[model samples]
Target chain A: MVKAVINGIPIEVEEGVTILDAARKAQINIPTLCKHPDLTSSASCGICVVKLKKNNRMFRACCTPIEEGMEIITHDPEIIEIRRTVVELILSNHPNDCLKCGRNNNCELQKLVADFGIREEHFDKFVRDIPKDSSTGTIVLEASKCIKCGRCVDVCQNMQDVWALSFLERGIHTRISPAGDIKLADSPCVRCGQCSEHCPTGAIFEFDETSKVWEGLMDPEKYCVVQIAPAVRVSIGESFGFQPGVNLTKKTYALLRRLGFKAVFDTSFGADVTIMEEASEFVERFVHKKGTLPLITTCCPAWVDFMEKFHPDMIDHFSSCKSPHEIMGVLSKTYFAREKKIDPEKVFMVSIMPCTAKKYEITRTDEMFASGYQDIDVVLTTRELARMVKQAGLDFAQLPEEEPDHVLGDYTGGGVIFGATGGVMEAALRTAYYLVTEKQFPKVEFENVRGLKGVKETSIKIDDTKVNIAIAHGLSNVEYVLNKIREAKKNNQPMPYHFIEVMACPGGCVGGGGQPYGVTDAIRTLRSKGLYAHDDAMKLRCSHDNPFVQKLYNEFLGKPLGKRSHELLHTDYKARPVYRK
Target chain B: METSVVPDIANVVEKWKDKKGNLIMILHEIQNQYGYVPREISFQLSKLLDVPLARIYEVLTFYNYFKLKPPGKYTVSVCMGTACYLKGAPELLEELHHILGIKEGETTKDGMFQLEIVRCLGCCGLAPVVKIGNKIYGGLKRSDIVNLLSQYSKEGAPVAQPV
Candidate 1:
């Protein structure tokens, strides 16, 4: 361990640790715009500059390694001024249209300005003729508000390993955007929202369907059904001024009801169906040698798109099943509509998701309901829905707790965990373990697979068979696993893992692209907490235990992978066009 | 949402009172028909899809890949994957940016070129490759960009239809 003093506070940290990391460990506040925990620290923005008093030297805290007995001045007047000047230069080219921008209070650049008290404009700002790009249909790119901070580029390249964006042009014309300055959609963005998730300004944002959802509420003839993902309950509360880890599913459901949704459904129900279909598919894949060995979960759209567009050879590995939200959407139209006898056409199935990728998932053409209608109508991020709830003048906190409507509402704890990283793997393991052994797991919590680390791998023997499973949340992590897979193939080695679980955004659907814009690592813990809390609070915690799902199989589905089940539940994946460049 | 991926425009309008999913299908139709979603097409489809223009606009801007304008005859894209980026892909894009005099996703003034950057083309071996329509140009250099673009059209003119 290395010992160091930062801002006069002493601390011990691991070797090769940066001064910024050491300062963070000592509870010292060293500001940074270019340093993300998961990114390769570039120290480009120069905002984390600190003076090493002993050596009488200054260095970027993000890149500088902490030495023994090193004394640092983090907030010296000269340092503050230098940092402020750097920020001023960044602001000089940025658009000051904060009020009109979508990321008003949620912008990182704005947050930095707020933190430093740079209220008065110290520099002239430029207004570009470039309007925002909405082509992606899943994100908003208002280049006018960009600070040219390469954090987005860093995350896209170093973290997610997608690298669709870059720093183009130099000097005042300098801009951070996708390659060739082309709109994002025409590229293989996969709509991960990590770039927007890490963007410090409203330059990028999730597509807003609040207005359409509001219209749905006002439509007298439409039966508006809303579904909330498990991660939303924890994160949405923050937008309402609540602290992280505060689970408020009941209140959120009640508030959705107050917002005029005809019926409120929990995405956990769809998650339950996902486990059933997924586990059954796994069984078939093993027993019948059908599909790929160790079928991967397709619940996360970001991962699905990544596999489809970039790794078409691995498409066979992805489970040919719709995500939980899409499954719920189909159920709402086919079953709920038939039950209500309302023209299925009049039912507006609005999915309140925690993912930005859900916006893209609903657009797949090969999926059914294409003969003329979209099954899943619209999607709003948890934050957007909270805004709508507040826009309606309701006190979200004080609203009396209400239960989700029956049937579509109730879900097991296993299903609820589908929102968190490694959740699908754990959920599938919980059921698969029992299905193989016909006995309960000695340990229900698969501690091996759960955590904040982007990727995790484990091998457990189930039913005298070694089941190797891998779970990855962020794109970077998934890329690492794929690289390993390729290396193994090159060496003519046996594939070690049987199943892989990947989410587009780090930490899974709870830490999704469309969630509230608190893109901090802090938000991941909070959202995952919300997901697990909901899981722990639920009565039925196993996929097979959902009585309603059992009834679904007996009365409707007829059995997992049955002709009727395939007709209603399963879907295929397409080898999406790989725009080779 | 009519519980369909693509809904008939007339049926959607007749059921417009609550036809929530019509806009998605309409947007898909527009995107499928054109190489990209043009803003004008979205405006027209908004009425047919029964979606408000502002709402359609919001959806268009949210996703990274959706475009709001006309694309070009031959879409030239560079793979910006990490393997590509480390191998001078960004610099190659800079070269194209200079040669094309337009950023990614924009049509040339004459509507003959559209330059873009995709995530990964799954060609780790050909790190600095560019794709023009279905043709892939491998092992590119900054100097070869102008001549590379000449294959599509003359310096400033649109590529006239071969027919």
Candidate 2:
């Protein structure tokens, strides 16, 4: 432990702890722009500069490690003035269009500017006239608004391993763009939006489609129905005054109803259906030897895009099931509409997702049109849904709790846990074990496959056979698991694992790109805990235990992987060109 | 798409394959060989070198040395340094553009002349200098641009004199 004096207060901290963290432990907040908890400190932004007590040499608090018997002054009149000047210099190059910006009040730069009370610009204004890149159709990149913090670059290249966004040029001429000045849609972006999530300013953000959703809702000829994803219920409340991870599923349903949706469904129900097909497919492959071993989950669209672009050879190993929301979209227009005596054409299905890639996933393949029309007409991020709630003048916090329509709204504990990193694997194991052994395990929680670990590996015994499993969340962590599998295949060794689950974003959908902003490890844990808590409180804890799911299989689809189920729920994957000519 | 260029680019990439931070050096070689880094070459390099196309372009566009388009046979560069700027270099550039019918960084449609602006040529003593090929024309006026450009024109292929 190293003893440090911060702001005249002495404290003890671990050796190698940054002064910023040590000061944070002492309850002092050092302002930072480029330092995100999920990324290593580049110290590109000098906003977190602090003074050493003896010689008073300036040091960046983020990158500097605490030493024994070091006295540091984090804040003073001179430091505040210097910090304010730094912000002013940044603002000089930044556009004064915050009100028109997508992040608006939610932007971290805007918050810091407000906190520092920067009312007047002291530096000469010289904003770059760079045009916006909206070609991706998932996230927009406004180069002129970029502060050159390098957070997005770190997230895209180092964290997500997408390598889409790169810093072009040096000095003031530097700007973020695809590696070769090509359009982002033409680059190997994969539309993950992790860059946008890590961005501090309005430089990168989700492509706004809320107005289109509003138009669909206002159309009299259209019966607009909506479904909320599992992760969304736990994280959406962050936009409001509610604490992070507070379950807002009931309130969300009520708000969607008040937002003029004809019906509100839960994606957890779709997740339940996904497990039904996925677990049966796993059993058919593992027990019956019908297909390849180590069936990978395809619920996260960003992961699917990554797989198609980078690992097309693994297509045979992917489960042929549509994502939870896509399943909900098809069922909303087909099963729910036919049962309710409504026209599927007029049924506009909108999915409120915790992902930006979900916007891209709606029309990815022909299976999305299984209901004879575009199953999901509009996809809104959790941020977009929050904006709609605010626009509708509904007090989300005080909205009376309400239930979704009975048919597609019912879900199980296994379905609700599909939002976290190891969720899909855990949920699939619960039902896969049951299908394999014809017996229910008393302990349902797979503790080994939980938490925000980059890569999690475990083995579960189903009757007599040991089922080895590996779960990787962040895209960067996926390469290790994939290389191991490749090594095993090269030597013709026994399969490294029987099942693998991957989510593109860190901590799965709980830390998804399009969720409410300001996500960190603490927030991811809290949001995941909220999902597990909801699962624990549920009566039915398995997908097969959900009575409505069983009814859907019995009445409409004959079996889990029957002809009708395959037509309505399954999809195929193909290798895609990384760059479009 | 061009199969002939693949082996050449692969050889260039092979030279820098073992080195760290070799993207800029590789791009410099590609630009030197082709006079500009073509999009197709960049795409091929991305595949051969196992680097993202975006990262390659990031390096290509960063330094002003790399160009994405071909240059003209006889390049005309007008110094726009501070000394030249005060001595009507901007007017000289405008007059040259009018005569050549090509903007800065662009080649003529017939592929004879290209116009460009340079920060400095270290010739402040000869303010407002214009260089075409190997010859330097210093202390040029706005009117001198047309005659200087016409000398290189196909119709008049007269032997030009350095000012």
Candidate 3:
């Protein structure tokens, strides 16, 4: 351990810990803008400048490691002046359209300026006249609002390994853009929105489709119906003054009804149906030797798009199941419409997801139009729903807890855990074991495959045979797992694993690109805990045990992987060009 | 939109394949050959080098040395450094535009000449300098631009020395 004195307070920290972290241990708040808990500090923003006691040399607290017996002064009059000048320079170039920005109240830079008590502009305003790029239709890039902090570039290049965004120039002329001044849609971007999620300012943000949803809600002829993803329930509470990861599923159902939805459904129920088809498909591939080994999960749309572009050779390994929300969408227009006697054409199916990629997934393939109409009419992120609740002037905290509709609302504990990494693997295993053994596994919880680990590998015993499984989250971590499969194929060796699960965003959908802003590893843990607690509280813990799913198969659709299920619940994928041009 | 890789460009890309941080050097070579980095070459280089086209473009556009469009037969550059600007460089540029029927950073319809504005060509001793290809004319007036164009038109080709 290294001992350091921060602001006259003595503290002991592990060796190589940054002074910012040491000050945090001493309970001193060192302000920062470019530093995020999820990324390595680039020290681009000089807001966290500090002084060493012996030589009085100035250093950035974020990147400077604490030395043994070193004395550091985090804040003083001189330090405050330097930090203020840094912020003033950044503000001079930043746009003054905060009130009209998409990240109006939730912006990091705006909060920092307010904290520093900056009342007036100290420098002459010289904002750039760069035009906005809304080519992706899922995320918008307002280049003028960028502070040139390089956080978004780090997340895109280093974290996500997408390299779709980069600094176009050096010094003051530097602006964030896709390579070659091309539109983002024409670049190699998968529309994950991780760049937007990591941006400290309003420069990058999810495309606002709330106004279109509002128009559909106000139309008298349109029967507006909405479904909520499992991840949305845990994270939406952050916008309502509740702690992060507080489960508001029932209250959200009541709120959606108040917001004028004809019926509210749970995406977890669609997840249960997905498990039924996916687990059966796994059995066919693993036990029956029907198709490719190591069947990869196809729940996350961003992962699907990434696979289609970067790893097209692995297309044979991808499961044919549509994502849960798309399944819910097609079902809403078909089974729900037939059951409720509503016209499929008039049903405006809206999906509240913790994903921006869902907006792109709605028109991704022709199977998305399986119900003879557009499956999902509109897709809104968890942040957008929070905005609508505020716009409606509804008191979300005071609303009594209610239930979702009967047929499509009921879900199992296995379905609820789909929001976290390795969740789909655990849920699928619970049913895959039953299909192989024809009996309950007794212990349904697979503790081996749960957590925030980048890649998790485990094995389960079914009867006398051992089933190998692997799960990976975050797109960068996927390369290692895929390389193993490619190596095996090259050597003509036995398959490494029977099943694989991949989620594009880190920590799965709970830490998705369209979740609430200011997410960290701690926040991901809390959100994962919320889903697990909800899962543990439920009576049915397995997907095959959900009675409503069975009823849907018996009454409306046939069995799992049957003719009707194939027509509506399954889809195909093809290789796509990296650039759209 | 035509992204088929040419054999010569492919050879150039292959030469730089093993070198670290060779994007700028390779782009310089492309610019030297074609007078500018064409869109098709940029796309093909992205595929051949396995680098994101965005990253390549970021390097290509960030420096003022790289161009994206084809240059004309005779390239004209007006130095707009502090010394040249104070000596009425804008008037000279306006007159050149009038004679060539093209704006800065553009080629004439006849493909005879292209106009550009640059910072210091290291000849500040001769303030208000204009360079056509390898020949440099220093201390020029607005009226001199017409005479300069007439000399080139009469020769029907670029002269090795300034008139």
Candidate 4:
């Protein structure tokens, strides 16, 4: 234990706890720019300066540990003046066009400047002339706005293991870019958007495509339909005044309808259908030995991109099923268009996703065009939808709840939980158990495969077979799980797992790169809790019990992996160069 | 001829693989051999060391010593230290730039001479010194820049010059 006094207030905390954390425990909030709750502090920004009374030496509270019985002065007139000077220096290099900036009012630096009452430019303005790079078509890199926080670099290289964004050069000339200063589209980016999620400013952000959707909606010849992903329902409420974990599934459907969509479907319905095919594929792979063991999930597009780039050797182990949104897109174009007697060409399918990678996934391959046209015409992120709701002059919190269009709206609890980490494994297991035992899986919930653990390994017994499962979220966690599989293959040992689920973002789609900003693990857990709460409250917990999913299988597609299902709901993977050029 | 001589990148990586700070050390070796770190060599080292190519570029670019492009046959170094600056070094540098048709840190079209403005060469007594390759010509006059450059442009010229 360590006892410390912060700002003359006595406090005690465990040893090795940073002075910033110790002060936080005592309700003393120290201002920080380079420090994030989700990342290690690099102490690049000199904002969190504190003085020790013993020697009167200054220290960065973020990186300096709180010494036992130490007297620390966190905030004072002198410190405030120093902090103000630091902000002024940062502003000198920063652009003055905040009103036109993407981050605008939401930027941390902007907030800090306002808080410090920086009304005048103290230092000479010397903003860099670096041009913006939007070559990825998923995220933009505005180097001029970068404050050298190192958060995006950490998120890209350390957390996601994508190594797309890097700090090149040094000192004042230091700038973040893909290796060799190549276009991000040519780099090993994977279009995950985690870098944008971790970025404190508009230096990195999702590519805004809201105007394209608006143009399509106004076109009289086009029949625009939209669907909301499972994670979008839980985390979208943060943009409004609601709590982090509040479920606004019905309200979002209502909002999309108000925005002039002809039909609003649920991506959870697509998730249920994905479960049907994926579970049956697991049965074929695990029981019949028709395919390789450890069938990996392909629902997260960022994970799909990473697998294609980094781990193409495991392509045979990858499940061929398309993601839920793509399934909904194809169904919206082919089945929904036929049922409503509308022209398929005029049907523009837009998916509201909690992912930037989905923007890339819409046109990943020819399989996305299985409906004879682009299955999904436009993809809006959850953050984009929030902006659209505000732009329409609609009171999102006060909007009346409305149900989705019945054809593809209804979903089971298994489908809704696909938003969280280890969710797909649990959802697939529920249906896979039923397929194997020829009976319903009594205990639908698998608590072992839950939470924000980096890698979760568990096994379930179905009649005679013991199925080993591994669920890994975040791209860095994947390498460990993959190494085990690779080692087993090399050694000619037994298979390590029968099933594996991977989500590129930290806590699956709930913490997606496209979700509301200012996300920490606490927020991720709350958003996940929202989905799990919805799952617990529902009557039909298992995916196979979804009446609409059964109706789709019976009415159009025959069996799980039948000709129509294979054509529309399944896709293939190919090895790709990490660097395009 | 330069393109035909592809040095073994594997041999360089193998030499530094067992050492600490190997990435930076290996990059130094590459810069020493090639006069600049090539993109193809960076890719090869990235695979050999199991490090990301982005990280290698970060190291390559952070240090000003490493160059990304091929250097010319001869380097024209103009000392810009306090002594040299006071002794008409700026005029000498301008004369070289005009004659070579290139600015500091740039090579000429024919790839014969590259211009660079360096700090102190530890020869303050011989202020306004201009060095070309291994030979140093001290107390240089701006008017003598044409004669100095022409002497190096000719092949099989004397490598040493009177200081």
DockQ, candidate 1, vs. native dimer: 0.02
Q: Tell me how far the alpha carbon of residue A525 in candidate 3 is from the true structure, in angstroms, after superposition.
A: 0.5
What are the runs in model 2 whose C-alpha is more than 4 Å off? B1-7, B94-112, B122-125, B153-159
TM-score, candidate number 4: 0.94
By lDDT, the candidates rank as 4, 3, 2, 1
**DockQ in order:** 0.02, 0.67, 0.72, 0.54
Best by TM-score: 2
Better of 2 and 3 by TM-score: 2
Better of 1 and 3 by DockQ: 3
2 against 4, candidate with superior TM-score: 2
TM-score per model over all chains = 0.76, 0.97, 0.96, 0.94
Question: What is candidate 3's lDDT per residue for A332-392, written digit by digit as tens?
Answer: 9999999999999999999999999999999999999999999999999999999999999
The 10 consecutive residues of candidate 3 chain A with the worst lDDT sum are A179-188
Model 3 interface root-mean-square deviation: 1.6
lDDT by candidate, in order shown:
0.77, 0.90, 0.91, 0.92
Q: Per-residue lDDT for A192 in model 1?
A: 82
- Native interface contact recovery, model 1: 0.00
Tens digits of per-residue lDDT for model 1, A6-46: 77778888889988878878777788886777567877788
State the weakest 10-residue window (summed lDDT) of model 3 chain B: B1-10
Clashes of 2: 4
